[model samples]
Target: MTNAVTFKILEDIARDLSSDEITFPTFLDITFQVRSALKDPNLSVEQLAKLVGAEPLMSAKIIRMSNSVALNPSGREIADVKSAIVRVGMEAVRTVSFAVAMEQLLKSKQMQPFENLSQRLWEHTSHVAALCRVLARKLAKINGDEAMFSGLVHDLGVFYLMSRAANFPELVNDKAELHALLVGWHDNIGHALLSALGSPESVLEAVRDHETDREISTVSNLSDVLYVANKIANRSSCWRDPELDGAVDTSVLDTLFDAETLAEIIDESEEEVQSLKAALGG
Candidate 1:
């Protein structure tokens, strides 16, 4: 395809998003409701269960996650949505719901042509999210659950670009060219989508700054956690190209975390990472 064709795909993506012509999955609608309900301190367990149970797929996801090795130490399975909600807590439920929503979005017919690439990207995001959870708990002194949420959706722009590219057969047929196109525009598209989706300021900020080289920023913020976690996850990801190892940066580890502490965190995170990846359908 010519440069004109490539540019048209980019323009369509922008226009579709701006005009709200892109139809995201219905589960996202349900997820937003559950997320909003979880924020109310006064929301009762019964009310919370009702909110979650209204969506059967999400309820199953919550219950299944509640019974995972990471969350359920007793080996007992949760048979009901309410019990699952109580066992996993509000934040975790929100995380799992979002994961389910994204999974549903990835399976849409529009993404059929790029299923392989989409699934690969989801795995990469899941790894970053798992590492972000560990980093926040071990170093950032922030909410680990929120950190994972931020990591999970960090590549919303890339996924959006991929989905948009599906409409243009020329783009999907050329992997290298598609990669270059996505890398060039995902950050901006991701920022806009997050804002329109009503993401928290901290989450939006972290996603916006995650790709920037803020090597000089001294504040131990979520962006730093995301950056370090993203790099570490990239290094270990299955989708990572072996030839790109030299391009990976390790200098930030010393600046963002103590060597001994970082080691311990990674050591402790292996099991949790596998458990979370499995839960998210990675």
Candidate 2:
């Protein structure tokens, strides 16, 4: 969807989301916990380890990556959850948190009219988050950690749009119309939603103005980073949209699109995604 339509949805759903407690799906509990853990670096390694193990899927990933060749130390062996969590750093835990939370967020609620929308949303969200992290790091000199969070949460407006769309299927089922509306309005919705969530100025700005830049000065900002990251994420996905591709500048993006760098990011992101997918035990 375009920024305009996205923003409008955000405005419409303003009454629905209460940031005070940050209501989320049951599946999001672990994600919230992990995010909390990330903020508290002093959290006991053993306690955090136990916390990670509390979720079998995330626990396995912690162990797998800790022992993998990518982070190969002289004799790094993650025998248990605690070792895995400590070795990977707290923020890494947050990534798993997002995946787990998102999984739960997508679980179909009996009352929700959009039967399978949540599931599809999360699948798309997770891939977007991964792509954002990779693309931002590659195209701009953006930090991976920031990219992780921005990519993960950038589409809160879309969530609201989808939920609302359930009540108005005719308005949403059409791609062209929805995309046009979104481009013109999502930024506003994103801006408001992010503001409600107490996001940083940088994040809020990025949420609002990510689609296009009025001046060259703002291009170096996180908003631009996410804007571009969003495009890259979409490109990396199976649900390819030709319309979305037209919004980006090929020449500028070409310099940043290096095969070697993309390969490295893809390799790591794939490993993480696969590991998480495995943890689901499918």
Candidate 3:
């Protein structure tokens, strides 16, 4: 509709976020609980198993991930929860837990009306996450897993907006209309939601700043990696929207890594990217 009307809708979305009126999928609660609990330095494998075991689906996913080709290149498969946790490491478990939680979130009954849109977003997110990991590892020498995690949740705002928009079908019934709202506000709204959810500082900054065309900080960080990875991922996939291409700042490639090097890196990581995407069920 009108710009004023759109602004009002965005304001309502912000209010819902602050008021905790917007609901996340049920599995996220368990994911958060386990995530927080895992942060305890004194937590033992037995205690970790006990905590994760409470949720059968989470436990199963953890085991499955532990056996994935990325982490467990060895042929030995992990059968027990304790072994799975040890095999995957706490950091990986935390990341995969959220991935599984997101899968549940996407499958929620509320998402049925926007299933096609949700799936597209999820696929884009998965690609971004894979590319982020590769970029972090090869270019920035950062923690690839953590970068991947950041990439996975970078678009939290888009999902939040869609779920809330489900409350007002008139605003989102048309695909073009909903996309316009997402393009306008997803970054700001994502920043707010991630802050509320206690996301890491690196991830929060990356997600909030990735879309902007700006100079690099004194030193390279995850944000730079995210911006580059997001562009590369979009280019490699069909998700790149022509209308939004000009919004990206290509200069980051020169400051960070040359386009040729970046493309080669992405090309080399094709197998790894596909494997990681399948692991995340992208």
Candidate 4:
């Protein structure tokens, strides 16, 4: 927890980043397969369904997401993976794959030591993702699914760092010290990790700049939507501990939307957000 230890941890991460040797959990195997499958333009719905069905948990989450209010506004429901895939689309299925992977990673024995932090991080991730979807659709006029995916993975670096921190018992037990290290390194680490994962350029850009403050009169791009969404979500972040962390400043939102409009958006999206969060296993 001392400065020397923090420097050493940062150095270790930097070495991994430079060498492109960042490690991912075993649970991400399914997620990688799903993403790889989705990249094939010739992949049929049935084929994707078959692939998804191979992983029972991912398949179940896909079906649940397809039935969520965010994706399925109608009351009608479908009971099969194929139907679910058709309803949610390929991108959404990819998002669900990540949702399932992260959920599993948190439950994995390796991450058990940081269960509390993992849960908090997941909750914050869900909130930001839901907000991104809503904000993208209602304000940015961008693809809601893409925005949601960006939000979900924006803090991916933090998760990876926590996983790595499992090797450092002292760091694991010191919440304040752990939080400081994560804040200092997550953004750059996330960008590198996403790049290594072959994430879309737009998504990589959003992740890289989500924490960077900038003046914007409106939400016009994915980065803008993510920035606004991240700020808003941080108002009640999982990383927040009054005794360990300081209050998050969201005043930049005032430059984008008036108080009434922002409140209205939050109010209207509350139900959908919660629904999507639950669908994502929040």
Candidate 5:
């Protein structure tokens, strides 16, 4: 794609977002429904289970997630959606809904042309999400589940941009142009798309700032946890190619945890990270 075409696409996307006309694929219907239902404070576990049951695949995935070692350290198991919802809590259910939706979106026919990129994106997302959960609990003393959810949705803008880019064969065929476009616009586009999806302000903030490098004495908040997790994941990120994109700067990590402590944290949490990734369909 030429400079003119790229600029035109960016301009069009900006106008659409400013007007609150963000486009989402049809597969997101279930996610929207689940999120809308989750907003009802009075909704009981049974009610939510009934709604989840309407989608058999998602219900099964939730059950599997509830049974995953990351969520269920106990050897106990749950067989049904209601029990799964009770075990994982509503926030986790929301995360699962998005996980399922993203997996489905990646497998869709329209996205087949970019299958490799989509798979890499999902792998990066899963790695960051699991790291966020572990770092939040072990270092930040915050809600690990919430941190994981934030990590999972942090790259939502990239997904949205890819979905739109599929319509332009010229742009889609040029990897360099496509990568540059996604890098330049994903953060703001993700924030807008999350806002349109009625995401929480805290989550929106984390998504918006995950890529910004900053000095930190501690991983104290959700944003801090996400930012650190993203940096760690970038070591094995889909967006990074050492030969092409150059080496990643990991100096800030030293300020957060000494070499040994950080290594220990990652080593101890390796199993949990892989378990959570599997649970989320990585």
Candidate 6:
């Protein structure tokens, strides 16, 4: 499938999914699945414990991961499922599990066209997540772990597109270059899909309004985080958009960390990506 057709199918899927009045049961199912596979973004660590503990499998995984040598910085043993979730935090738990758990759900024949696409998407999202953290701490002088998580999942719309390709072969066959073809368009699509899936308003808004002009309506801070995080994606390759270079809507851009700080963060993120590439023998 070419890139053009993929986006076309995505548009159709978006329209069809949007037009269908999702029933309460369906809504609840989506909510349950998203929640079950991951923790609530708004829930506190203690709250995450109770929520995750409700599901035995997730709790076990959480506990095992907390006891994993890599995540447990201090190497303290977790006593319970809740404690494990609290120690790791909801997004971290969600990040670890969602990618692992959703695999079977997203499997299909058309997924072949996207062979390695999903893997690259994960790598890109993870890098963007890391960049978001770097930007938040070094540039904005703020904690952006949450921002990093948001960045990590922002391009999930593309994943949904791949999943739907089984149903829409034209979309599966889209042939254009990926970045040039669908950049501005996918935000609304992502927003609607995740909203239909019962994500929080902040996440939806970040997806839907991330690219919307402020004159149309001011974007939320979370959207700002996504916008800049995406803008700096692929180690500043996306930032060369002449269309957006001098454009207004300084709301997020102004609040973005200073240019010098951003430069440092970008350099560091490049190093991180390179290190990851080297680790993978790239």
* Candidate achieving the largest TM-score: 5
Q: Write down the lDDT of every candidate, Cα atoms only.
A: 0.76, 0.57, 0.74, 0.85, 0.85, 0.54
Superposed by TM-score, candidate 3 places the C-alpha of residue 77 at a distance from the truth, in angstroms, of: 2.6
Error of 5 at 23 (Å): 4.6
- Candidate 4 per-residue lDDT, tens place, 158-251, comes to 8878877878788887778888888878988889877877899999999999888778887899999999999988876656565676777788
TM-score of 2: 0.62
TM-score of candidate 5 on Cα atoms, chains taken together: 0.94
The residue pairs in collision within model 4 are none
The residue pairs that clash in candidate 3, if any, are none
Error of 6 at 30 (Å): 8.2
lDDT of residue 79 for candidate 6:
68
After TM-score superposition, the amount by which residue 48's alpha carbon in candidate 1 deviates from its true location, in angstroms, is 3.2
Ranking by TM-score: 5, 4, 3, 1, 2, 6
The parts of candidate 5 lying over 4 Å away from their true place are: 20-23, 242-244
Q: How well does each candidate superpose onto the true structure, as a TM-score?
A: 0.83, 0.62, 0.84, 0.93, 0.94, 0.61
**lDDT (0-100) at residue 216 of candidate 5?**
89
User: Which portions of model 6 show Cα errors greater than 4 Å?
Assistant: 1-12, 19-31, 34-82, 95-97, 101-109, 137-145, 177-184, 211-220, 236-260, 266-282
Model 3 Cα RMSD, 1 decimal: 3.2
Tens digits of lDDT, candidate 3, 112-223: 8878777877788888887788778776899988888888888877877777677666665666666778877889888887777678888899999878877664225799
Instruction: Give candidate 1 misplaced runs (Cα > 4 Å).
Output: 16-27, 35-43, 73-77, 216-219, 238-251, 254-262
The candidate with the higher lDDT, 5 or 6, is 5
Could you give candidate 6's per-residue lDDT for residues 1-282 as a string of tens digits? 465665576567756766767432221243345465454445566666666666555566567656654345476888697677666666566544443333323344546666555555556565566556555655455545566556655766665544555565554454334434445445665666667766668667776765665432222366666667665564433322344234323444435546786567666666644432221111
Q: What lDDT tens digits, residue by residue, belong to model 2 across residues 1-282?
A: 444554555555665564455454344567657666656657877777778887887877667655654343455576787767667666666666655554544454531654444554555566656555555655566775566567666665555455455545555556566555544555676567556545568767776765564433232556666765565455544222455425334233445546686456667667644433333222
The residue-by-residue lDDT of candidate 1 on 255-274, one tens digit each, is 76578966787788888887
Instruction: Give candidate 4 misplaced runs (Cα > 4 Å).
Output: 20-23
Which 10 successive residues of model 5 have the least lDDT summed?
A: 236-245
